[model samples]
Target: MTAVKIIKVLGTSAESWEDAANEAVARANDTIDDIRGVEVEDWTAEVENGAVTEYKATVEVAFPVREGNP
Candidate 1:
């Protein structure tokens, strides 16, 4: 049997929501192993003078728990 865990993270980019989601996964990869997938929960934008200055993403990352470890 395998176990899975979910963690929430936030990422921001000046590009787009897709970039922000990618950034979230990339950063999580730095510390997390056995990553299975990511779910983009929400998206928001920061506006500056009626223009989108940044894109923010709320991401849920899923990873498999190591065997023989709790």
Candidate 2:
């Protein structure tokens, strides 16, 4: 049998929500391997002077569970 793990991370970007999510995954890739998928759990943004200053994405990252480890 195969198994996987899921974790949540918040990514922020001055670009766009999609970029925010990409940031999260890219960061996760720094240490974690075998990244299976990503799910955008939520969306948010920061506004300043009536203009959107930043975009935020709450993402769930998934990766496989190795044998003899969790």
Candidate 3:
């Protein structure tokens, strides 16, 4: 049996939602390990003067729980 944990993250990008998701995961990886999965929970965009300026994503990231390290 294995233990898992989930965390929510928000990421933004000038390109697309995919990139935003990737960015969130990448940033998470900087401090986290054993990445298992990611769920894109929401999507949004930033508008500037009636034009879409950026894309944003809300994600749920999952990974195996580690023991006795923290």
User: Candidate 3 lDDT, tens digit per residue, 1-70?
Assistant: 8899999999999989899989999999998888899999999999999987899999999999887867
On the 0 to 100 scale, the lDDT of residue 42 in model 1 is: 98
After superposing candidate 3 on the true structure, give the runs of residues whose Cα lies further than 4 Å from its correct spot.
none
* TM-score for each of the candidates: 0.91, 0.91, 0.90
Range of the 10 consecutive residues with the lowest summed lDDT in candidate 1: 61-70
lDDT of each: 0.94, 0.94, 0.91
The alpha-carbon RMSD values of the candidates against the true structure, listed in the order shown, are 1.5, 1.5, 1.2
Candidate 3 clash figure, as a count: 0
- Residue lDDT tens for model 2, 1-70: 7799999989999999999999999999898899999999999999999999999999999999888756
Q: What's the true lDDT of residue 38 in model 3?
A: 92
Task: Tell how far residue 17 is off in model 1, in angstroms.
Answer: 0.8
Best-first order by TM-score: 2, 1, 3
Superposed by TM-score, candidate 1 places the C-alpha of residue 9 at a distance from the truth, in angstroms, of 1.1
The true-structure Cα RMSD of candidate 1 reads: 1.5
